[model samples]
Target: MTAPKANAMKKTTKPAGAVRPKLAQEGFFGRSGYFFARALANLRQNVFVSVVTVGTISLALLIAALFLLVYVNLEGLANGWSDKVQITAYFDKEPAPLAVAALKTTVKSIPGTKSVTFISKQEAESRLRARLKGQESLLEGVNADVLPASLEIRLDREHRDNFAVTHYVAALKKVQGIGEVQYGEEWVQRFNTFMNFFRLMGLLLGSFLTIAVLFIVSNTIKLTIYARKEELELLSLVGATRFFIKAPFLIEGVLQGALGALLSLLALAGCYFAFLHNAGSFLGVNPAGAGLSFLSPLHLAVILGGGVLLGFIGSLTSLRRFVNV
Candidate 1:
């Protein structure tokens, strides 16, 4: 009878490790369902407060998104300008066929050279005439040969700075058959300095705006939490874990943030299309000759993530500061 009883016990009982996974899965699903339901109930119970909080978050995120877009485009423009920094090396005489080939090869071999384009006197004169537009007739009697043939040298990005350009210009000036090397030295230096300053200002402004959004959203969430204080207290009284009580509000915050971010994205898309349709020419072309781009895939992800993080932090603040449970 004792041996039979031991065999029956072994048949009825299972190992703890095997049972734990199944139990944990059920617990997680059950907890998630409960939290979702509670969050929906909270929203339904305070429709006005919910709208107000979501609206506030939407506006804040919209403003933040706009600044990010502007900063990104301006930075692109700055880089485009940097890449366009070129030195025009004018020749004393029109280069011979063999000399031109050798000059091209020599310039291409330069350490920092990005590209070298040889412009003939005729091409230079034609460009000048195009620029002169209505005043092109002023060059009616002028000899095309008076305009010197030149080599346009674009430097690599790392060598585009003022110091690097100065050294590059000096080196090019020493090359045979080159009369002068001209790059907008003073202006390029000043522009680079300005770009650095602008980036710094943008960073500071973004930080301040982010903090403002957090404070506003936290206070707004606080109002919602205050309205449901009694319910929260009752849940605590019923032996609900702190995680259980806070889970719903946390979910609510994230949903609100995501919704706000979605709304902002829609608004931005509309504005982007409207702006491009109305003023495509205003934003200059990139090196590829295409018009300016909207936020990249990575940046769009960042904006959404930023919104969710802002909401999570606000909810966490309200729960810790006001709700004991």
Candidate 2:
């Protein structure tokens, strides 16, 4: 046929007046739909790669979240221990009952003092008897006068720190009736040292983990960018706006981050419950009974938001190398 035209073999071209739709010209809803559709399509196009990226992010976040849980519990335990810290001042001679009451009133006015109780020699001896129930006969010669009378001072939360407690003790020494003021100097110093060391370790570990997450996420996104290099370049050549080219990628990253965070939270919940269930025999401890708690609402929000931020940062970092900005 005079040759059936080679139209079937010819490359199709748009009419001279035809042009691609400009997102800026569209309404807000239309623009949003376009972006979501494009992002979803990209995800579908590389389903396996997307899944892997999300899984990696979830695993990384899970490890960090787990450590956070442990650190929070340790902090709570430290606070509880701090509450038990008390200062006991031994008297050279038991103060008069009126003097003891006045001293108690004054100590209560001090910055860190929570409660103060006067322990008479007789009361102190009685306590020892109660404590040494099995060896009561050992106190045969011990009378009420044998045990020293003291004032027991319980400090408020803020004053439990070594420096604060020491300062408070010095203030006590300034009082007229006090002979010796002690708050377990050696033990307080050691407890503070341990707490400081533990906090430093947690900070270092958290920082390193954060860096690892950013680095790995960035490289993963970079790999994705490389896969679509030609398509992006072609769009640029056709005069697609920079925002148009980058919007889908940004959306994709946020999606991955959100999905990863949710998945990690679910995994964390499962692990936490499993541990709690088995703790009775495995660790011989009752977590709930000991005042251990799960993440608070604020903590949960921070972790979820952090995941989204990581994804956005990862995508942005990868895109900067491929796209101009």
Best by TM-score: 2
User: Candidate 2, overall lDDT?
Assistant: 0.82
Q: TM-scores across all candidates?
A: 0.74, 0.85
Q: How do the residues 1-325 of candidate 2 rate in per-residue lDDT, one tens digit apiece? A: 2334556434464476667665355543558778888989999998988998899889988988888888888788777777778999888898888788888888788898888989999899889999999998898988898778998999888788788988998889888777988778888888889888988999998899888877887788778778887877887889877777888888899999889988988898898787744553465556654446678889888889988998888888777777762
lDDT of 1: 0.81
Candidate 1 similarity to native, TM-score: 0.74
RMSD to the true structure for each prediction, in A, is 8.6, 4.7
172-228: candidate 1 lDDT, tens digit per residue: 887889997788888888977887799899999999988887787778778877877
List the pairs of residues colliding in candidate 1. Answer: none
Q: Model 2 residue 252 lDDT?
A: 91
Count clashing residue pairs per candidate. Answer: 0, 0
